[model samples]
Target: MSKKENAAPTTHTSESLFGKVNYTWMLIGLAVIALGLLLMAGGNSSDPAVFDQKEVYSSTRITIAPLLILAGLAIEVVAIFKKPKA
Candidate 1:
Protein backbone atom coordinates (compact mmCIF):
# COMPACT_ATOMS: atom_id res chain seq x y z
CA MET A 1 0.00 0.00 0.00
CA SER A 2 1.18 3.58 -0.78
CA LYS A 3 1.26 6.23 2.02
CA LYS A 4 -0.90 9.32 1.47
CA GLU A 5 0.77 12.74 1.65
CA ASN A 6 -0.50 15.42 4.04
CA ALA A 7 -2.07 18.54 2.53
CA ALA A 8 -1.79 21.06 5.37
CA PRO A 9 1.55 22.79 5.99
CA THR A 10 3.49 21.23 8.90
CA THR A 11 4.87 24.57 10.00
CA HIS A 12 2.84 26.72 12.36
CA THR A 13 1.87 30.35 11.74
CA SER A 14 4.05 33.22 12.88
CA GLU A 15 2.37 35.40 15.49
CA SER A 16 5.00 37.94 16.55
CA LEU A 17 7.93 39.66 14.85
CA PHE A 18 11.04 37.70 15.82
CA GLY A 19 9.49 34.27 16.34
CA LYS A 20 8.18 31.89 19.01
CA VAL A 21 11.76 30.95 19.91
CA ASN A 22 12.19 34.46 21.23
CA TYR A 23 10.37 33.64 24.48
CA THR A 24 13.64 34.04 26.36
CA TRP A 25 13.08 37.75 25.93
CA MET A 26 10.36 37.56 28.55
CA LEU A 27 12.83 36.06 31.00
CA ILE A 28 14.96 39.13 30.53
CA GLY A 29 11.99 41.23 31.58
CA LEU A 30 11.59 39.18 34.74
CA ALA A 31 15.28 39.41 35.51
CA VAL A 32 15.17 43.14 35.11
CA ILE A 33 12.24 43.41 37.49
CA ALA A 34 13.98 41.27 40.06
CA LEU A 35 17.21 43.19 39.71
CA GLY A 36 15.48 46.53 40.13
CA LEU A 37 13.68 45.29 43.19
CA LEU A 38 16.88 43.87 44.61
CA LEU A 39 18.86 47.01 43.94
CA MET A 40 16.18 49.30 45.27
CA ALA A 41 16.00 47.09 48.30
CA GLY A 42 19.76 46.70 48.62
CA GLY A 43 20.38 50.40 48.66
CA ASN A 44 24.07 50.12 49.44
CA SER A 45 23.22 47.81 52.28
CA SER A 46 26.66 46.49 53.10
CA ASP A 47 25.86 45.35 56.63
CA PRO A 48 22.59 44.17 58.12
CA ALA A 49 22.64 46.95 60.65
CA VAL A 50 19.79 49.17 59.57
CA PHE A 51 18.01 50.77 56.60
CA ASP A 52 17.72 54.50 56.34
CA GLN A 53 15.84 56.58 53.78
CA LYS A 54 18.88 58.79 53.33
CA GLU A 55 20.96 55.75 52.45
CA VAL A 56 18.34 54.69 49.97
CA TYR A 57 18.72 58.03 48.25
CA SER A 58 22.43 57.39 47.66
CA SER A 59 21.90 53.68 47.01
CA THR A 60 21.86 51.69 43.80
CA ARG A 61 18.28 52.90 43.25
CA ILE A 62 19.89 55.32 40.83
CA THR A 63 21.23 52.41 38.82
CA ILE A 64 18.48 49.84 39.44
CA ALA A 65 15.36 51.77 38.48
CA PRO A 66 16.67 52.91 35.12
CA LEU A 67 18.08 49.49 34.29
CA LEU A 68 14.85 47.75 35.17
CA ILE A 69 12.76 50.22 33.21
CA LEU A 70 15.02 49.98 30.18
CA ALA A 71 15.12 46.20 30.32
CA GLY A 72 11.34 46.01 30.69
CA LEU A 73 10.92 48.29 27.68
CA ALA A 74 13.35 46.23 25.60
CA ILE A 75 11.58 42.99 26.50
CA GLU A 76 8.24 44.50 25.56
CA VAL A 77 9.67 45.61 22.23
CA VAL A 78 11.09 42.18 21.54
CA ALA A 79 7.83 40.48 22.47
CA ILE A 80 5.90 42.80 20.18
CA PHE A 81 8.39 42.62 17.33
CA LYS A 82 9.14 38.91 17.46
CA LYS A 83 6.91 36.43 15.64
CA PRO A 84 5.32 33.33 17.20
CA LYS A 85 6.97 30.79 14.95
CA ALA A 86 6.77 28.95 11.63
Candidate 2:
Protein backbone atom coordinates (compact mmCIF):
# COMPACT_ATOMS: atom_id res chain seq x y z
CA MET A 1 0.00 0.00 0.00
CA SER A 2 1.14 3.62 -0.61
CA LYS A 3 2.20 5.79 2.40
CA LYS A 4 -0.62 8.26 1.69
CA GLU A 5 -3.16 5.45 1.72
CA ASN A 6 -1.78 4.07 5.00
CA ALA A 7 -1.79 7.45 6.79
CA ALA A 8 -4.69 8.23 9.12
CA PRO A 9 -7.14 10.89 7.99
CA THR A 10 -7.14 14.18 9.90
CA THR A 11 -10.40 15.06 11.61
CA HIS A 12 -11.62 18.43 12.83
CA THR A 13 -13.44 19.01 16.07
CA SER A 14 -17.23 18.80 16.19
CA GLU A 15 -18.29 22.39 16.85
CA SER A 16 -21.02 24.69 15.63
CA LEU A 17 -20.02 27.76 13.57
CA PHE A 18 -22.83 29.86 15.04
CA GLY A 19 -22.73 31.17 18.60
CA LYS A 20 -25.39 30.70 21.30
CA VAL A 21 -27.06 34.05 20.51
CA ASN A 22 -27.58 33.09 16.89
CA TYR A 23 -29.21 29.84 17.90
CA THR A 24 -31.39 31.68 20.43
CA TRP A 25 -32.53 34.15 17.80
CA MET A 26 -33.22 31.33 15.37
CA LEU A 27 -35.39 29.58 17.96
CA ILE A 28 -37.23 32.80 18.73
CA GLY A 29 -37.89 33.37 15.05
CA LEU A 30 -39.16 29.81 14.70
CA ALA A 31 -41.48 30.30 17.65
CA VAL A 32 -42.77 33.54 16.20
CA ILE A 33 -43.43 31.87 12.87
CA ALA A 34 -45.25 29.06 14.64
CA LEU A 35 -47.38 31.56 16.51
CA GLY A 36 -48.22 33.35 13.27
CA LEU A 37 -49.23 30.09 11.59
CA LEU A 38 -51.31 29.10 14.58
CA LEU A 39 -53.08 32.43 14.48
CA MET A 40 -53.91 31.84 10.83
CA ALA A 41 -55.28 28.36 11.48
CA GLY A 42 -58.71 26.92 12.51
CA GLY A 43 -61.28 28.85 10.49
CA ASN A 44 -63.25 25.82 9.30
CA SER A 45 -66.89 25.20 10.18
CA SER A 46 -67.95 21.91 11.80
CA ASP A 47 -71.24 21.82 9.89
CA PRO A 48 -71.35 21.51 6.10
CA ALA A 49 -74.48 23.74 6.01
CA VAL A 50 -72.80 26.51 7.96
CA PHE A 51 -70.47 29.00 6.35
CA ASP A 52 -68.69 31.70 8.33
CA GLN A 53 -67.12 34.23 6.01
CA LYS A 54 -66.37 36.62 8.86
CA GLU A 55 -64.39 34.01 10.76
CA VAL A 56 -62.40 33.06 7.66
CA TYR A 57 -61.70 36.67 6.69
CA SER A 58 -60.80 38.02 10.13
CA SER A 59 -58.16 40.73 10.36
CA THR A 60 -56.10 38.63 12.79
CA ARG A 61 -55.69 35.84 10.28
CA ILE A 62 -55.31 38.05 7.21
CA THR A 63 -53.25 41.01 8.38
CA ILE A 64 -51.76 40.38 11.82
CA ALA A 65 -50.71 36.79 11.13
CA PRO A 66 -49.09 37.67 7.82
CA LEU A 67 -47.25 40.58 9.39
CA LEU A 68 -46.04 38.38 12.20
CA ILE A 69 -44.85 35.78 9.71
CA LEU A 70 -42.98 38.38 7.73
CA ALA A 71 -41.39 39.76 10.89
CA GLY A 72 -40.30 36.27 11.88
CA LEU A 73 -38.78 35.72 8.45
CA ALA A 74 -36.89 38.98 8.76
CA ILE A 75 -35.64 37.95 12.18
CA GLU A 76 -34.47 34.63 10.75
CA VAL A 77 -32.60 36.36 7.96
CA VAL A 78 -30.96 38.75 10.40
CA ALA A 79 -29.97 35.93 12.71
CA ILE A 80 -28.40 33.95 9.86
CA PHE A 81 -26.35 36.92 8.61
CA LYS A 82 -25.41 38.43 11.98
CA LYS A 83 -21.75 38.30 13.02
CA PRO A 84 -20.71 36.92 16.37
CA LYS A 85 -19.36 39.31 18.96
CA ALA A 86 -15.60 39.47 19.45
Measured by TM-score, the strongest candidate is 2
Query: Clashing residue pairs in candidate 2, if any?
Result: none
Give each model's whole-structure lDDT.
0.69, 0.89
In terms of lDDT, model 1 sits at 0.69
lDDT by residue (1-86, candidate 2, tens digit) is: 89999999999897677888998999999999999999999556787687788888889999999999999999999999988775
- Lowest-sum lDDT 10-residue window in model 1: 1-10
Residue-wise lDDT of candidate 1 within 1-86, one digit each (tens)? 33445455479785545554566777677777777777776534676687666677754677757778788878867776777766
Best by lDDT: 2
Candidates in order, TM-scores: namely 0.51, 0.78
Q: Candidate 2, overall lDDT? A: 0.89
User: Where does the lowest 10-residue lDDT sum fall in candidate 2?
Assistant: 42-51
